[model samples]
Every structure is written in structure tokens, then in C-alpha cells.
Target: MDLLGNGPHVRQARRDAYREEDSLRTRRDRFKGFTNITTGSKGEGLTCCFKSDSDVMRVIDNVMCVEDGVNCNNISREITFMILNFRYYYHGHCKLRLGRRDQFIHPFVRRALWNDEYLSKE
Candidate 1:
């Protein structure tokens, strides 16, 4: 079958021709897929990454910290993001609760971050 002879052949050829061009699109899709995970984003596609559950808890623990203490770039990344797992802090923050065996739901994990019950001592 010639590359562009029949209708089906033409369609297949077009798909194949664009596959290379769609590499960037494919990467974007895979990147977007990461948000589907519990350790991933629970809200919309747009998000700002935090450091750790404990860190988030620390901020939420203090209503004042949540406001007067800006958690923006001004704050030290090491202090704001110092989590139980150094590896996770080094890599990327996930939804794993410290000293627990289960993975909490994405939203709940985010919520637990505000709760002192889930906060790690360290």
C-alpha cells in the first residue's frame, strides 16, 4: 500500500506524520497526568507546591502564621518545607503522612495538613 493511496492509508500516514510533531503535546499530557495521583493536585490543573504535611500543618497550626507570616519566597525554603522525609523534601512533596502506613485522599491529606493530629513531632 502506497503511503497516500487509499483513504485509510492517507489517514494512517497523516497520523504517523504528526506523531513526531505531537511529542511536546504528549509530554504535556503526561505532566498533567501526574496531578491525578493522591500525592498529586486535588484541585484544578493550576497549583503551587508546598513542602510537607508537617510544614503545612505548622503554618495552619498558627492562624497568625497563615497570614502575617507570608509563605512566599521570602520565607526560607528549608524552614517552610522541612518535612519528616528528607528524601521527599529533596525530591517532591507527596501525600504520605509521616509514621503512617496508609495514603490519605488528596483533599483529606491537604486537610489533615491543617490538623494538629497528623502533624509529626519532628
Candidate 2:
């Protein structure tokens, strides 16, 4: 008999519990105008064994990232655009700079700007 209860059924039960918890957390974040994207071991439903830390990425809904050469003439005025500058970094990583001078700057991003330039992934 399995005294420790470390069988396949037990493992699957743990994963299902963790997944339900994550779904609730994600729903809460959505109400706050942010999307929670889970990653790492805990996100993959591997919480049956060793302890794992939760890694979540909260993406803001009002902020938008666009390419350096993309035309923003048709974009909504309420959305804040962060122009991606690829010249300073390699692929898959880039620095987020402010868009056109006429563009409206969100208060949150405006407070973090350094000389009208946003933060980078350096």
C-alpha cells in the first residue's frame, strides 16, 4: 500500500488545486486593469514536490509598445505609447522610449521618465 500517498493521483490533485488558485488570482488582477501572466514552476502546475516561488508578470492595459518605425496616426489618443528602441539592445530586449512629442504621457510613466526618456532593459 502507498502510505505516503505520493502516487500519480495525488500529484494530479495538487496540480489541479494550484491551477484553480492561479485562475482566481488572474481574475482579480484583471479587475485592476492588469493581466497577470504566471511563469516558472508554480505556473506550470508543478507544486506537488519542492516549494516553488510564484513568478507573475502584470501587464498594464493602457500602455502600448510599438516598433520604432510604426505609424501611430490611427492609434487611440487615450492609450499611451512606448516606442521600442532596438538600436541600444539586442533582439527580444529593448528600451521603451516615449512616443511623439504630441502624444499624451500617462502620469505613471511620466513620473518614471528620465529627461523625457523611459526606462530600458539594461
> Candidate 1, residues 1-122: lDDT per residue as tens digits?
34434355554554443443345444555634321112222122122224223111111111112222234344332222322333434456433333322322233344546665555342
Give the per-residue lDDT of model 2 (tens digit) for 27-50: 877767776665666555555445
Best by TM-score: 2
Q: Which stretches of model 2 miss by more than 4 angstroms?
A: 1-23, 29-31, 48-50, 88-93, 114-122
For model 1 the TM-score comes to 0.20
TM-score of each: 0.20, 0.62
Give the lDDT of residue 60 in candidate 2.
Answer: 72
The C-alpha lDDT values of all candidates are 0.34, 0.70
